[model samples]
Target: MSGTGEPLFVADGERDRIEVLHVEDDPAFATVARRFLERCDPSLEVTSETDPREALDRLEEESFDCVLCDYDMPGMNGIELLESLRESYPELPFILFTGKGSEEVASDAFSAGATDYFGKSSDASEYEVLAERIATVVEKYRTERQLERSEERYRRLVETAPVAIAVHRGDEIAFANRAAADFLGVDAPAELIGDDPLSYLDTDDRAVARERIARLLADEATMESLEERYVDADGNLKHGLVAGSAVEYGGERAVQVIVRDITEHRERQQELERYRQLVEAMGDGVYALDADGCFEMFNERMVELSGYSREELQGRYAGDVMTEAGLETVEAAIQSLLDGETDSVTVEVQAKRADGEVVPRELTLTLQPTEPGESFAGTVGVVHDITDRVKRERELEAQNERLEAFAEIVSHDLRNPLTVVEGHVELARELAEEGASGEELVPQLEAIADATDRMLSMTGDLLTLSRQGDTVGERHPVALAPLARDVWSTLDTGAATLETRDPGQVEADRTRLEQLLANLLENAVEHGSTDGQSSPDDPVETPADGADEGLTVTVVGTADGFAVTDDGPGVPQEDRDDVFERGYSTEQGTGVGLAIVRTVAEAHGWTVTVGESAAGGARFEFHTDG
Candidate 1:
């Protein structure tokens, strides 16, 4: 805008610092141009190149506000240089300060995108005019470059923002960022240009978005965030939280909208509702307590397990529900979690039930965080009743002690007398053979020897019965058919046959399990059938056609466990309950066989029951643990 020669000297304070690129064919003239340009305004820095083509290459490498060149030069001229630079940098200032004073050349300079034109002069006043023009052009170029840089930074920030951002003029979208385009299911931001934001919303929410936009433009309300549903390109409803505010854009009032996706938050709310329902229906007590051990939250199961109403437990301390001993345990467990010694702790305590009975219960506590450093904020607890488990353990201990006493009695008391009686029978049989009166006493001596042998046999059974198969430590999957055949080998059965049908695997201790199978086999052969035949070389005779037919024993696998069945006389229904009684014997053996089988089964947490087999014989069924 500096036009007249006198007004050109009007200074706009001190001029801004700028670098200029000057090109001339003469090295002496390039030096003169730098001197005068710096003298006009001390803030200007001028770089000169004698070769005009090299100057253009310098412009491409280095940053400069403006380019100064002569109109006439060898090979490429100033107009040709201006035309070449225009291809990439149209905003760069190119001024012609040449010796050629032709109006036609000046017209061509401006047409090639020259910023200003000046003719070379030896006059000192001409250099001053040219310097002022150079300063003005460079200052204008620097200001426009700074504006472009600032807009570039803002554009980058909007494009990469996590939330959707769009600038709207009236109802149409003027600009949109990458996130905004993606939210609308478009490939590029330009596709949203001239599109209405309301069109992306469902029909139900479009009016709400319109009303909010109207209120923002009218200045009737301050900026507010709201949850709404927007429709994507596929017409699927998408949940979002959006905020809109009036902003000055493009020299007009426009709305700048920011939207955040909230579909995950909605899904989380639904999940929490389902968890609440599930916890309320649980059987074990579930509760949450604060760091001070006061109840913060609880489920319906907690009220039932603690024997307290919801009203009573709402603000009550958890220690009040537990006894002094229980409180001691509770305090230690909570301290362990708070000190970071462990993440969770479990302990057993006595809890008072609603019926005034103190039930044995186990409580488990887990650490939780309310804030970053305050991870000891609260503890989640689960209480489970263990009364039955405790009672069964005590009964098992008492049963073991009784078995130990029985073994001692059989070893010391019964064995000594039976051994002495067998010794006397042997001496009497030897005396009867040596003397004449001994012939009559030989049968009596032999009868006495047979009675002692029977007594010894009964004594051996007593000791074996005293060895109650109590504990079975680690159980393995034992194949029933092989184990049954092994057990049958140990038993003295003659005509009795062992049959296995689908004898699948059962988890049991092998040695103790063998004993169980041996007892079951003995019971089947001895007491199962009175008419069952023994081996042809045996002394025991069979009563023909009694309750036994084939006298077959079967080991069959059941769903939960296995069964040992027989085709002999079945136990009467009235006597089934007393079959496992300790001293109840029917025929030749100590009655403790079935009782020992029951003991071993109990140790493994199995249930033993006697029922009639399919062929009218006794079936011993064992059910495995739950």
Candidate 2:
């Protein structure tokens, strides 16, 4: 369809479309060239431009598959135009067509980025060769453009990711995309592009990181992970988890490092460690198990209570060392916990020790969820050796039965005789009144009344002691602050002052917590004050050291639970274990107060311990589930 003498046009019907631009001064040659291209492929869209300047304008206006230009023209020579077109669209295939083809001119065209050079020859099929060469160059250019776009998209994705991503070449940081640059506190990746990664690490960690990277590159490991310390832009040391993997970069082998900040996680782990230590130091046993009911961890007290060595019990199944019935009970308790039936479960069972001895233990299991959407993995159990407690309870029960029999005998059999004696005394007093001796008999009657009152008080105390273990109170979250205030307000000793600090909450029995607080407050007021006065000039000084004003009560929350501190004389180290025993008071009052506190706390499955307070006095900490 091109005019006569115009370059031959090719139509590639198999392709979606084909466009060709032909520039020639002779209309006759363009006509012949276009016919030859159309015969090669019937769908060719060939446009002929006789004016060289017009051809350049057309090329600027539209995209063409290939351009065929003649060597000689009126205003612009073909070689000059070809040089200009290559500057703008270097990848567009250009073929020089000329009537006079010299080898020197052809070499010049090829040097100017021409695809190929050809001459109008006598041979009939020369135009066909030119058309075939144009098809090859155009297809190659399109493929190259697609590859460029794909690489561009991939580069953009890596630059915008949230996690730090870096590329390394040998030991140098070759590229650290945007996220990694910001994490390392650098202006751009270029700043660190050529720097060795060791420069960013601590002196001691540099060799370690380098070795890890080397091992990764050698294929000895798929990935290497370590905790690395680095000085940030602010010159402060920061902790991060460094993970490295092998990669090929820029035609050379390298390793990629991913740094993640773990400062908060590390701090939390340290806090848990401190809590574990505190629990291990206590008299009660503590055990932490994993999801499969295997012992993941346990404190020394737990090992001692179960009579098992720590090495022997760790990683063992709980059911293995327990009696068959005990194992069944524990499994049911664990199943209930997993099914969300209860937050905790308590059961008394006998456990076989490492030496094959069986001990009675009261195990209280509390479930803690480590992550959301995960099954109840394990329980933290507090086990107490209650064999001795049970023995003492039985002894006290027998004593109570004997006392009850004696009371019944005295009231029914002895009281009648005593009443007759009192009546005879009263008649004697009346007769004496007539004889003027009633005043002397009045004193004797008053003594008998005093003795009876003392007996009644003793009976009341005995009854309270007997009923202590029989009562099982419901447990709940009890806030310590308001409870302490109530206890302080109820004490009628005007000379003694009460001061309480802010206290958090703990899961415990409200009545028992109040009772515990009252006992401790009364103890502090009685022992830390002189002549019932809490003033500075009192004979008994504050137990706290210099700059401390006076005895004060403070309740504080801890990782395990809550603790009550008092700025009063602390219990002697030797007496710490004995202070919880019944009738062991150092003061004049009966010693059942602290004993009651212990009994109530133990009933709720909590551990009570004595330690030094921050205020330089006794601290009683109760570990209740919070």
Candidate 3:
């Protein structure tokens, strides 16, 4: 095929279809150029043009693998044609084929965007050089095009990535995406070009960030992910997590950062940590157990209480950590929670601590499942040391036993003597009256009888006071108005009037409540009535203390509890606190009346405060722990 007598062997890969155009002033030379290329590869499809102008025009309408144009053509020379065609197709393969072979023409053609040049000869062998030039230029063009396409795709991928992405090389910033611009508090990434990324870090954190980057670049450390504070647009610090890896960017190796905003997540983590610290620092033991009764989490207080480290308690069974008695009660409570029988449970256990000190503890367990269904997630336990409570209870039992013994003595031993004394005084009075000789001794006999009766009454009152220490557990709804009226009927109110109001219904001891009311009413009549009538003891002239009667006592209901007040002489503020003492008494009053009222209220879990009444007298209000 060529004068050199060399044969062409195509490679074992798929051959590219080569399309080319040839131009010359003579039609014969155009035909020759086509033959030279076809001889190089049979896959070549070469179109020939005799007119230089027509060849340039045809290029606009069709694509070609390579363009071959002759020098010294009519309208355009080889170099001129190369320059003209390159205006539209700069990368189109163009080879100058010319009979005029000179360094001047070759230099001119190459400078005018010619891909290669050929010295046209009369010998057909010279055509081989032209064929080689066309193939080489086309192959080079194809390689460059593929590289451009690959680079384009990579750019688009980074641009549309979800996280904020940036490319930085040392202190120079190369490129950044839209998210990166927003994250960096800039209008565009172009503004960040050639700037250090550490500018976004706080002053104190910048050095740390720089160290991390240095380590990553040196391959000494992998900064795959790190959380750092970044200053926002307003110069306020925010949290961001930087992730991703080193990559080649902008013709140099750079670190490609994918920044994620973690401000909210970090805040939540901080709050959870604060709550954990608070729980750990508490005096009570706090813990959580999974459905299988294995410890899920336990605060520091729990570790201290159990004498175990945080590591020792991990995944350990709660029952296994507890003493036998404690474990039994705790497990029962947890079982009740799991069975959906109770929302919470409290049990007293004489548990042994790590130091081998056995003491009573109150274990309160609450279920915390995600749903209301029977599926058990876990339980939260709050433990309190009830050792002091148990000690006080034991002491109270002993005191009650002694008081019961004292009450028996007062009821039996003291009452029998007072009964005999009263009988003798009555017999003496009868003798004075019947014999008619000791008329002068009758008053003395009557006075002695009165003293014995008063002694017996005081003995009975003391016995009642000693016995009311037990809680008022036996209670029924008792209408207080009817009870007040009934108690008033028994009271000897000489010139005092009783007023009853609807005190609602209080759950109280029927007998004890009536006794409490009786004491309160009797006290009102004794030392009451600022507008004083005659004292039962004095029989002296005193003004009436009420709008109608000597004194008025009111028993009425309040929101939480009830009150017994009187339009009578109120206790002074200074004496109010001492009035609850057992031996406390006022002028014209028995020493034991109000003290008895306090004892009954305390037994019923009620509190009383002394205040001035609306009528300028005593207002003893009973407030229940509602």
Candidate 4:
């Protein structure tokens, strides 16, 4: 491109067409010159104008690569035209070809900035010579412009780069970017120019720097970065990573180096390594899960708890090792934290092991801490195995249940028998004071004795439950049928009948099992009566008066254990769930009978459930496999 008002100049070799403008005073001569130039070079496209002033007007309106003009004729001479064109189109190629040949005219044409000066003659070869001159001047003009544009682009790239960039010409700094100046604590890159680059590096690293520069300039394919220390403008030491390669700068071999300050980065890495060691040494299982709920980090304790190796668990989804219910619980907790509803969550879940075993575990989860202005990345959790703790809690609960039953008996059951005894004693006193017959007094005494015996029996049972605390002493094989018959004989069942069917042996604590059986039989005998009487303790619907009769209790063997069924009004469907609770009675007796039965069954590691019997009575089923 011409610097004087032209858009851009297409290089001669690269251009598909070259346009030329010819100015002459004679119209015929201008026409002939245009034809001759075009014929000499098919790539040349020429336009002829007779008036020099008109030629300048055409040049202003159109684009051309080169201009040809005559030395003399008409209003302006070639020297005058060349001088006038130079004012506006300084870089445009111009050749002065004239029929008037003189040493003075040629010297004036060149002085006026003509790219070439030639004398026109009668020889036909003159046109060819002029054509070559036009091509040479235009190509040189375009080549110079291309090189200038390229240099400008490279300069901009170096100045704006983030890392420190410097070009070393021999042993002196030929160039330095803004970043290099800032890194060296200088006000501007000009301050670093012409200084030895080695002067910036520490004395200890100067030798290595020199060797590296030599290797780079030799083009030995050195791509490795060097860690070197430098002295800033303030005379303080600093660290950087430097990389360099051989390059050409201003037609001279040079080494272009890029420097990155990494002092802070190295310190941060050291701090992180310390934290990693602390985490690995923790006792409890610690784990970190990424946003996708996959394991990103864990300690040795975590591997042991999960029974999975580090390689197996890394990047694996958490759901793969957790039970479905547990995974859902954890997911919900994570959502609650993300919503800012909670800072942390602790939950007990079943962890499925690689060996197909389920282990009870407690986990405390919290969002991983992040730097300010950073988003939530993942979760951190600490795991604890709570199997032993859970077992102890169950035992404590069982003991509490027993204590509750004992309190009820002492408060209500024992008081009732004591009140009965007091009433009978008062009646006997009145009978004696009125001089009643001895026979009448004897019946009152017997009633007092019966009440006293009942109180004593309840006291003994309470003492046993309180002292034992639901703990079974020892286990032995016992026959169910004989045990039931023996317990029935001891109970004052009134008119109730007992039936045994398919008796079997069960491993149990004999003393505890017998007490369990006795309580069940007593519960049935006391409540299974359809006597049309609703005791204060039993709040069920009373049967019809004529329906008064004793009920039959049956002991039946089951595949896993046994059951006690009674043929009487069955327990209310709504009340079955609470039947074994302390103080929940459906009969005329202490409400603790079934509660003791449950305590004993649990102590023996058995499960008990109450349901309706086929004969419209309550059925108590005991499973030994609990």
Q: Which number leads on lDDT?
A: 4
Checking candidate 3 for backbone clashes, the offending pairs are 531-545
TM-score of 2: 0.36
Candidates' lDDT values, in order?
0.76, 0.70, 0.73, 0.81
Kindly report which residue stretches of model 1 are placed more than 4 angstroms away from their true locations once superposed. Answer: 1-397, 400-469, 529-550
- Lowest-lDDT window of 10 residues in candidate 2? 530-539
Candidate 1: worst-modelled 10 consecutive residues by lDDT? 1-10
Tens-digit lDDT string for candidate 1 (13-114)? 223556778888888988877888788766678888888778767766676767888877898899998898788678777889888889999999999889
lDDT of 2 by residue, 1-626 (tens): 23221222233312434678999988887888888877775446677889998888777676677788899889888889988887777777788888768998899999998888888786768757766776776677656765766688866767786656777855788878776776678887777788877776756645656666778888836564678777655566667787777788878788877777665678888999999789978888888887657787888888776666788888788877788888888888878877789888889888877777887888898886666656566778988889898778876885676456446634643453456557757766776877856676766566456445434533444455466552447768777778888888886433545554556777767876776777766665555543332221223432322123455667677787777776656665767887676545442234455666776677677888987777567788888762
TM-score of 1: 0.36
- The runs of at least 3 residues in candidate 4 whose Cα sits more than 4 Å from the true structure, single-residue gaps closed, are 1-158, 165-259, 272-410, 432-442, 459-518, 521-557, 564-578, 585-589, 600-606, 611-619, 624-626
TM-score for candidate 4, please give it. Answer: 0.50
Off by over 4 Å in 3: 1-167, 172-196, 204-212, 224-226, 233-236, 242-252, 256-260, 273-277, 309-315, 321-325, 335-345, 369-374, 409-626
lDDT of 4: 0.81
